[model samples]
Target: MKYLSSGTKYDSCNQSAICHAFGPDGRCIQLYKTLLTNYCSGECTYCPNRCERDVTRVSLSPDEITKITWSFYRKNAIEGLFLSSGVIGEPEITSQKQLEVATLLRQQGFKGYIHLRLMPGTPKYILDQIAEVANKFGVNAETTNKSNYSEICPNFDYQNDVLQRLHWTDRIIRKKRKEFRGTNRLVGANDTQFVVGAVNEPDSEIVNTVSEFMKKYSLRRPYFMSFDPVPDTPLSENRPSPLWREQRLYQVSYLLKEYGIKADDFDVVYDEHGFLSNSDPKLELAKANRDMFPVDINSASFSDLIRVPGIGPISADRILRSRPLFEEKELTRMGVVVGRARPFICINGKSQASLSDFLEACS
Candidate 1:
């Protein structure tokens, strides 16, 4: 309940749950995110619902879940549903219940977005059924590597269970895309979540693993969840992962997924411990390559524009799209952070702002 109620926005489909989702027509839509049931049989060391102790076990029937979701949807409380559940008896059993909710919603003409979790080891047929009704799918890889998987979630298989399910999700979504031809039923994207700092995995491994997935599968992006120790769990004695580390990962992920920034480029920000430092990755890169400063916004390439501190792909493209060009003040209007970008950008092939100015302004 602590985790759920925290309402910490997760990076799913390039949007946060705290901020509402935009519909196809650009309307904002709220999502009702919840778990189907908290019951589980797996003994993942970090999970509160792991089968070791006498935790409260609760399960909601598929019909009950559908009623609650439908009621909310009809009343305009939510525009969609984000449903997940721990493995009840088997992966298939839990998956079937989720599929039921999706199917029922679709049958009732509920066309809003539905993000469903693909349970590990779920059969291909069940996955196909889920693809028919879901807008996006998620399978949490939790850790970076198989070796780390043993240290963290020993009950689950890294290859056959986790990776294979991700593979199936990619394949099914592709097949659905071909079948639907960009219809609403076509699942737009898939994502994975990683338990950052668990099993002592470094940021490099986590980013690299997600990069590999992006290359092979049709993965949209990866979500980073800071490891928070739950009471009575085996990992309760371990130190909780710093939230700043998770925030750093998200920034790095945006650079990789949105800005086309390569994962190898992260070597510039990683410390001796192989973890990302508290400094923002973009600022660190800028600090390291001082020669690239004072980029001409009017003449700089799209790639170079993104390398600047406060300019993103969208704002950079907006700058490029302007016909008559823009003044220094106009940069902020185009969504550029003038305060952060001033030192790094040149308005008319002239450098005015300095590192000292940037430091002082930032301070």
Candidate 2:
């Protein structure tokens, strides 16, 4: 059993990939990701798999895929299979074929974990059928800005098809959960890779879009792939996003989930130049809005708890709950990093004099 953390980086041939690895009973579960075919018809500027390129593309037959999965499963090499493919031919045809493989796996009694990627432009009925067979389904908006859709994914229409498919998939997942009643297992929903540096869109926009998806569909996970310049892609010459910027986006995303920070609240101003790249977005926000901080930890609401640097919503709640038991001195003594926390939080109505003052005291 292997467990992949949210921030764990996995080394791959062409790029470093990030994924969550779930483990059970002190053992890490094996997660296998493979593409059915690297051949694609869509012309996404940032994708290595886009059509019109002379890359070595391979497509395993359904039987071949099944055999590979069974061989690994029999040895407990993997707990599940994550199958995705570059869109080939019509979306309907490609999607149906992907579904056929998943259905066949289930028919063969291989039901460990099957997660299928739903390509944009897939029919609603086909999506439903895929949902019926798959344990999880995922789709990638790729870019958040609508204008980039044309420059990035030229063949895929953002308005009519892609958005519709996502909404329909959400509806189907909801419907299935309802039909299965309380006993039915929830089907996980995921979004695809965000090409971080391929376009000029700010991190704020990308995170906002993801936040909305999480709120709307209770999406299980949102995978962020920092844009790497793939050889021969239209935007191959484009620089990759600054690593810190990508890291901050992931941090802010965690804040959004753990601290309940709304995307709008942290929406950064670009200055007609570019997104902020100096400090972590949450730290920047906390520094800029000094008035919001030094919140009385003893009485601050859960929402207020998240406004403090280093303190997320959960920690805030823990503070509020533990206030009755621990005094301010005790909390500081309990290794809460009082120096960093002092500027943003108050202890029993007593605010820190200043960041410098708190630092001095802590030092």
Candidate 3:
């Protein structure tokens, strides 16, 4: 009776704001994200809706949620739904309600993207049901370490609650992958979110945990939430994680996952506090490996080209496919952002563009 409301601008999704979520096929689609309810049993110290907090809590029925989502889709306002909820009574109950909303959406033939947040400690049967319907699934591992997790979310079991569910998601995704090979269909991928600067954990711990998750769980990606202290929460006095810190993490994560950069390579990029610099990590790595620089754009391997800032895999492949003896202008047309890549590349055995050349172009 206490917690019933329309919408809260807490997550990346909202009706007016089109929060684009990447699908299994790597296409970005807008999502209609909202909480199913704000009621909760797990009294996490940092959350605004802890059992003791006097916030405006609300629960939307599955039908109500479906109607709103379908309406949004009908207007072409959103391409999908990202549904999460507070732990109401039992975790399973919350999970079931969310599943019901997703099921209702599917039954109504609203076959757009649906990213379901798996509640910690939810039963395996319920997990399977949700997996079948969701286009992507996520379970938030708020903190990196189990001890830190206990400090933040005291009631939750780190092993049985969080990681186990991630394991289940991985298994389901693998099974789904086997079932959906070679078809136009793209099977869902599992992602986890981390609350950066929460529990005073270092960037090293955060990235290490991400590495472990990727290696062990076949995780698709890690989402970073810069911790913002809410008034009345236990961590109200704590400082918010800088947005730049989160951005740097994404850069490092990309380097690790996409660029094939190893964890040990981070030693060159991370500062004394194990925090990454605000500068682009790719540029930092490139500058560090000076001997590898001034790479021959015409002949360098795809791997080498991507190491340079602004040169992505697609553009690198384009370079490979394009006619030999590439000119400076041709690189731009191939999607290689020459400005960023210029300092690191050589065109026909000469530096593609010098600092003065860039200055002249800018002037």
The numbered model that scores best in lDDT is 3
- Evaluated against the true structure, the overall lDDT of model 2 is 0.69
Model 3 over residues 168-213: C-alpha lDDT tens digits? 9899889888887887554677788888886788887788888889
Q: What ordering of candidates by lDDT runs from best to worst?
A: 3, 1, 2
Which lDDT value does model 2 have at 245?
70
Instruction: Tell me the tens digit of each residue's lDDT in model 1 across 267-286.
Output: 87788878988887898988
User: CA lDDT, every prediction?
Assistant: 0.78, 0.69, 0.80
Q: What's model 3's TM-score? A: 0.88
All predictions: root-mean-square deviation over Cα?
Answer: 5.1, 5.9, 5.4
Between candidates 1 and 2, the TM-score winner:
1
Model 2 CA lDDT for position 28: 35
Span of ten consecutive residues with least summed lDDT in model 2: 6-15
Q: List, in order, the clash count of every candidate structure.
A: 0, 5, 4
Point out the higher-scoring one by lDDT: 1 or 2.
1
lDDT of 2 by residue, 279-349 (tens): 76777788767768777766777787767766655566567667753355666554455666766776765
